[model samples]
Target: MKDNKQLAGPRRDTIETFEGHENTILAIATFPDGERIATGSRDKTIRIWRLEDGRETKKWGVKMIIGALVISRDGKQVVSSEGPELGDDEDDDEDKVLSRFYQWQLWVRDAETGRVVAGPLDGHTNSVFALDVSLDGSILASGSADRRVILWDTTTWRRNGDPLLCGAPIACVRFSPAGHGQLGIATDKYIQIWALDRRERLAQIKGHTNYNGSCNLSLSWTRDGARLLSAGNNYDPVIRSWDTSTWEQVGDPWSGHDADQHIYRIILNPAGTLVASASSDNTVRLWQLSTGTEVARYEHSDDVLRVAFSVDGRFVFSGGLDKKISQWEIPDDLLTTARGDPLSGRLKIETTSFNSPHKHQRQASAARGKQKARVYISQSMYILTVNQNLKSHLVVCGFMITTSMFLRHF
Candidate 1:
């Protein structure tokens, strides 16, 4: 079952002023209070920004390109790790045998002061690609190219276990929102659930094939802590739901977008009503869980790399290949109604057509598909049908009308 609801919201201008990077921006993290945002760039620096004023808060120097950035649940600490650095063939002579190995480090800093608090966590034998902080804000879990997921005490900066080994580079790690000592870890082709108390694996979920050499897999837990969601870099993007009680797959995979697009990130809203994904196709898509259908798609000039929703669920922030951060406003009325009722009235327009060639005389129609439009009921819905070859001012006028209507209602 797929639910395609009309997204009613303002189309605000995207702020585009960040300096460009040589490579794609990999990850973004916001402070707990929502005032500050930090971005990990392949440019070898972590840029922190003041979201309210749209100003640079600070920039930290890192030696190599960063792969990920994570802020503690309490918002007091920030952690970042670098991607692997390639060694020159001349340096990798077998006879010379000069250690070709590279090590990744996790640097923890105070969020407010922008000062290093703990590391350069010098332990991972390979690039550290994924990181997560526990719900209680006591432990930090990181996954690395070393094929191990290590747990660290936030206060003591010590390893929690012998390092949970997955036999392949760990791509991502997430702490269950339930704060029940449950953690989810993703490697190249498998997802494993571990019990934090015993430091033992509870279950392993396997399905992905043709796993890319780059670690791009993502895993997240629903707010209720009853279901788990996982997605990764494959032709068929799989959004799987797992029952927490029985540790069983509850429903069929929610598949969308062709296999050609690489899904870089998948994030569930704090309320668990919506899931947002960023793709290499240069678009960010929002999906409603109840219907398993995309409700909105926001286009960008470059591939979207990271997206994060505010704790209140009213705004979505995305960072992309263009090296800029964009904030999207979600309609408050829609969010409120959707939470109260899983199925809200949505007005869906299907197959809009124009009756006349004359500009002002044209009449259009909409199918009102399945859901009644609830968020913007009183607002006008504008539809335009045009020929493929037509590139006149009329088309531009029609787009303007639609854009205006969306902003006014949202």
Candidate 2:
């Protein structure tokens, strides 16, 4: 059911805790369909979750602890970095004698049935640290401990070209949000930008330093691909955004997480307006990307390892040592798009325009800045009504119109 209440004070964000994984949840990815999510955990199993209700829809096992996961653009296939690892040299058991041998490579599987569709794509010689699929799902990028970032052609599930070599082991890799033409690769010391389409290294950014050397940082591209965001851990626990065009830092590094823990991962919501960070401090936090202002926080039982956003940007999913995926409800009235901007089309514009205040409404919105804005929309009328201090603040002569009339204007 939709929440329509216009209450006072800060928005009350609620969370639904989902329990399933036996070990720490290491990675999370939302299905393009928005109805489901895929969570990868140290338990060596990936579980499908229904978003409408906290239901574990499906499950599949892999050979090693899942390091990363990305769903194909069509929402049909899930690409995961999987493989086995050795414990102490004296401890010969793979999983304490679990599995003696297994291949460590990227696996592309069917989203519905968990069937391998294209790969055990092989190239990297070590643990896979990152995986990202292009917007069109025509290409896939995988970064590994071997210091190689390999691009694969999704159609043939084959290596697209020679691996993108780096000076140090790769911590993460991401395809630009705007398209597949550009890629970002990170090592402990610096982040390298590459023009993937031309097979050339563009520039290297040294904005972040990973103190612990775990190579556990993350990278994300802004919606337009004009900027890139990166975060690291240990002594250098901070989130940094950079301009892709100039490869320049955007603003001061964002800091809120505990100084001693690692920020496992960071992702931007679909609208690219909000940033969500998962950390070892046992909390997932949401921030305004433009201002770096901390917006909301969700607590976990243990270290939070990964976070994801629904395609609609209405909800956020976080998972970690708690062995669960938490679904958080974004405030209904919190505008998803930029302030004072209308949605792209009539259907979407109405939802956005109603939230964003126009120049004429600035004076009325100033006082409501510290308060939540409630929007009332119906087929009968489009009214700019705001609720605050338990009273209605109506702008523009306090008038409302029918839905058809509103549609005609947009």
Candidate 3:
């Protein structure tokens, strides 16, 4: 299972590459069937792909940059958290109103047609960074840079409650996957668990921070909803978890990921024993949840932004700054390798495959600080700016940004 199927080796294989995203891939969500996936890119389009042959199935052009994406449990809807493309001209009041119109909005689209069924579901005044569907598909929770968590009724696509205020910008939000009726709200230093039925914070666990203080970037819930894990950026380059039922710290912080690099996501496998982390260190690292051990790692050419496990837990798909979705099959002896010993995870693809030669050249140009591009929108005169650094490649045209636009993630 070498990177190239033809290569003669027993290493884990890179099975398929889902290509088509024109910009940095910001989000990826696996469909219920496990054979298809929906990915959101800074390209402002969500493309659905069939995993078998990496064929594009459907695409939806969105008005704003994608922040995060999640599919309803029933697989009938695709809900995406999108942020605004900032405008330069903000001196006039009329222009101000127009700018507010485009800021962080949520869109719920029909899974089959990719048509907007409901939204510009607006409530948060700032960029929405996270979105998660409840276990029953009845509640949709959104966390935002505005430092709030808002809930909406899936049945009516309407806000269900007032915003839950936090001390800092919310980096991620996830409903307990175990049907525990709890929502985990993550910020820089705290992971608060709220009881959905009571609409009150049930538990608040703090004190987990990385070298640079903290910037919690993502969260994951165990399949049984017993453990809630949180991840932060480079300075705080470690993953910490809590026992949901007791609201107590679970284990020693899991750390073999390179320091001073953002762990964009840390997704738990369906079995809930393995943790696959997508990192800015240009690699996807797998860890054992029970022992905090580095089991396997997949090398990527550029910063890895997102990671997702298939429904059946046999394959792992990752997408990122490379703009390509690389599918890696889990090693056959996932749990039995060296009797599940240390550093046995088996992916070794080094260079990333690009969709076009122009993409390769653009990246080279970017390294030399001469790369730039634009997306024309006849509706407004905002000029899109290409990100040229370690953070997300976001669009900041002439649109009005009230708070001087924050970094794409933090």
Candidate 4:
């Protein structure tokens, strides 16, 4: 099936807008039922919204800026974390001495009743950058700036074991999609798979170079738990798929973006055939998993910090520095268009032309040599002109004209 044509659907709609955040939104989490959307902002608050109406359902204030957010698998709990803060001092000498104590807290809340269920989990000694919940909703995993990953029992609200050690700050963490006791972790340059049952490092795949300061931004397990994907802060953005059985790199890295775009998040569609990436370049690119080919690139005016696919995988919700939540529909037709040749299939290029303020007319003159020609499509007509012909071009370019039209349809 050639998925080349743009999917025909309603234009994107603004579902809801939340006010009160003084800074950019950092992270967002959606409930399993798709009824509630939770957002963590630099304003030190987590706001819950009704997905249908975009109305503010609830808001909880934290002491510091929240960097990560996650909802439990059962949609009954939420976990949020703030970066570490400084301690208070009493005397002048004590105040002059800086104390470097770092702390992370996880707050579990009831999704429907808006009640705090468990904590303020205070275990990690640094900023909590990533959080994930198990399929059974009984286990929670957290990655932190202190170079550790921790598993917590959701029911008992206790640590599962000694924190999984790492060489660098853990940037992302996720549970296996098969509902098994397997987890994935990403740091600066390594992707590590750990077995939850044995509490042992299963495999570590390392080859990619790390960005100077930023770490890998996202990790996801394929639906069947047979593969894993990782995206990060390199100029050559890669979507690496690894076999779950042997933990080997299964295929070539998906590389299309040449600009130094940092991928902030990656989510595989429920069908396991499509993968979507939210990036720093203010766009979301969707790719086919089997072929590692780009399907569509959704553009935004500002940086896209996070993105999530609906449970049915028909719509994508993206949030970013713009402080607006935009919903994009993934039409079957657009997917069809993307699968075909973009350059030769129904080519459409929109351009603008402005004539000089002065009006002038020149005779039709022919150049001596036949040079390579390029076609420029304006709003109304196709401009078949040579680049080096100066006298003919300068004489007739005097009127300022504006036009708007489509290129082709078939």
Candidate 5:
């Protein structure tokens, strides 16, 4: 066993690995205060940990595989999905209905005690893949493989209205950050913005192609609710942003990532100035929102599935296929350098569709010199340095990092 004091050393941009899950971690979420994190794993358990000291606070053993997880904004409740626990009960017909027909259940539990508070909220006829809570904590939205997005009234813990039929299997759903009654749904290769207040579809934004939308591809909204971001899939691996006001492509598609690097999720910082991308290429990259420049890249042990920015915009957390979670600290000097006049550069839209089309005013040469020397750590033993050139270069050398311990995978 390792000493607890050694694990609580100084904080840096180093890769700190937390190991507890016996299987792949499918979902991860941080509380609003960024002090605690909730993770659901295929190991059939949900565990909570403190951020300051890597200590497990609470854990709950679940019956079925956990597909997704979401915590309320007030940090009072947690919602998770558990597909039907299939079995060989030949006499039970409902078991056949659940196993063959894809019937699943959603559980609402107390965040502090891990006690069931409301569910087995039964309604969806298939596995639930996505879940989110409204900013006001009054409503909860869930998406399922049955091609439905259901809204629930948290006050009474009852279904609010008839299910919204998404044409394809629902991949992801989120409420707009503006706190209005709008919802963003991602299905197939398109993004549909729905106005929940009016109970109708608001707009369907098009232009990039993707294989399928069922991989928990994240859809993020800027804090002001002015724009939305979705990193394209294996078919189209570009990061696309949409102007919510007009629902049009914003400043063409941001592309520079290798074509083979399939993007899994994208997250915007709290300040709404930078976007972090998780990809299959075993790397995470941060892009400047205004200029669409790839600023930094952090490598991982395997394909990254989920990435999130801290509420305070100081650090980013990521977990994926490698069964590990990595936290990286953001440099204040780097953000200070990137923070500039959003209107300093004139933005232009491209008439062409899917093929990469982007245009932006060139950043001054002198500014690049001052923004150099931002370093990032990944899964490899070496270090990854992101210079002012806006490109990632890896150094293949190893060094000893004292006071850092790597937990056993098994």
Candidate 6:
């Protein structure tokens, strides 16, 4: 039987666009249930939108540009970072000129009313770049250019531990999905995993150079917490992944991204089979994790900075420099790749061997041209059939047959 692979399409439908921000949207976070979205913008405003109708339900203004945002899992609260002005005019420069007298702040607010609940979470000496809450909602981690990452207890609204002395200015931080008291910190050229429970480094992953100063880059983990994904900056435009079990790069970097454009954000679908990346190249791409192929791409008019998948993984929401949020839908067959994977069971650990790359021996042949493509395809099929020991023989044979047919047709 043929594996259910849909014919590739030229485009994905944009079901709706949310607009209201007067400036570039810098941050976007969706409710865990996917019913609502919260965004922060360079316009110094935050808006909450009902995803169902693309309606802005609440809005609030702040004193400084909003750079990062995160919504609580329950959808009851939101937190956003304050950043430098969107422009560097003399007046803004003068404000920086008097930096000795002022400090920036982060806010935690009621998600529905836009009311500040607790904040000016004041400790960082510089602009806040990233924010993440622990799985149980008791701890919040904030990263800043001040060269520190702080843990704050939600109940006391106070710092939870001594400042994490990351020597370089912090770029981004994310709590591990496993909730095993782990934190992913990206600073300068390294991605460090810190064990919050022990207050020590758990793993130090080195790859992907940093681009600019802004916390525009991001880090995400698969829902299973088995794989971690890192988006690249202008200095490094490839999306790299690491097996959490060993904290090592899984395969050759997923390339084809524009080296000049920074891959601002990356996220995985709820099922963990697809990865969505938003980039300065004016597009959002969905990559098949198993094949490492970019299966779908959606176009945007300007730099696309942020992207979020709906709770159901049915839709993708993106916002950016264009001052608009767009929703995209993938074809059903493409989505089916995620559904009943041997790794997706609720309580079972994903031990599928599909996580490893298929060692292709025809690189030189394929690189030459179509004349050698047929030979390359057959060798690839042989390798797939021989190397896959964990997946069903029928499934592997089906994939090989499908690829053989595609190559013949080509």
Off by over 4 Å in 5: 1-13, 84-101, 210-216, 338-410
Model 6 root mean square deviation, Cα atoms: 14.1
Top model number, TM-score: 6
Residues 118-223 of candidate 6 have per-residue lDDT tens digits of: 9888888777768887765678899987878999887777999898888776778887655366788877657888888778987876657533432326788765
Q: Which model, 5 or 6, shows the larger lDDT?
A: 6
Per-residue CA lDDT of candidate 3, range 1-410, in tens?
11222211223557789888898898899876456799998899999998778899998998767988998765678999887655635565786755664477898999889888998788887777688877556788998877889989999999887778777778788876544467888887777778777678888766355345767788887654657888878877788877776866777888766767888888877545688989887778787777767777887888999999876566789999999999998786764442332221121112232222121111111121232322211111111122222122322221211222211111
Please give each candidate's TM-score: 0.74, 0.76, 0.75, 0.72, 0.74, 0.78
Segments of candidate 6 deviating more than 4 angstroms: 1-10, 86-88, 91-95, 98-102, 210-216, 344-410
In model 2, how large is the Cα lDDT of residue 173?
85
The lDDT, on a scale of 0 to 1, for candidate 2 is: 0.68
- lDDT, candidate 6, equals 0.69
Candidate 3 regions off by >4 Å?
A: 1-13, 87-102, 210-212, 245-248, 335-410
Choose 1 or 3, whichever is better by TM-score.
3
lDDT of 1: 0.64
Better of 2 and 6 by TM-score: 6
Alpha carbon lDDT of residue 384, candidate 3? 16
Over the stretch 32-118, how does candidate 1's per-residue lDDT look in tens digits?
Answer: 554677888877878888766778878877777888899875567788887445553445676433232345688888877769888
Residue pairs clashing in model 6 are: none
Clashes (N, CA, C under 3 Å) per candidate: 7, 3, 11, 13, 0, 0
Alpha-carbon runs more than 4 Å astray in model 4: 1-20, 84-101, 210-215, 334-410
Ordering by lDDT: 3, 6, 2, 5, 1, 4
Candidate 6, run of 10 with poorest lDDT = 389-398
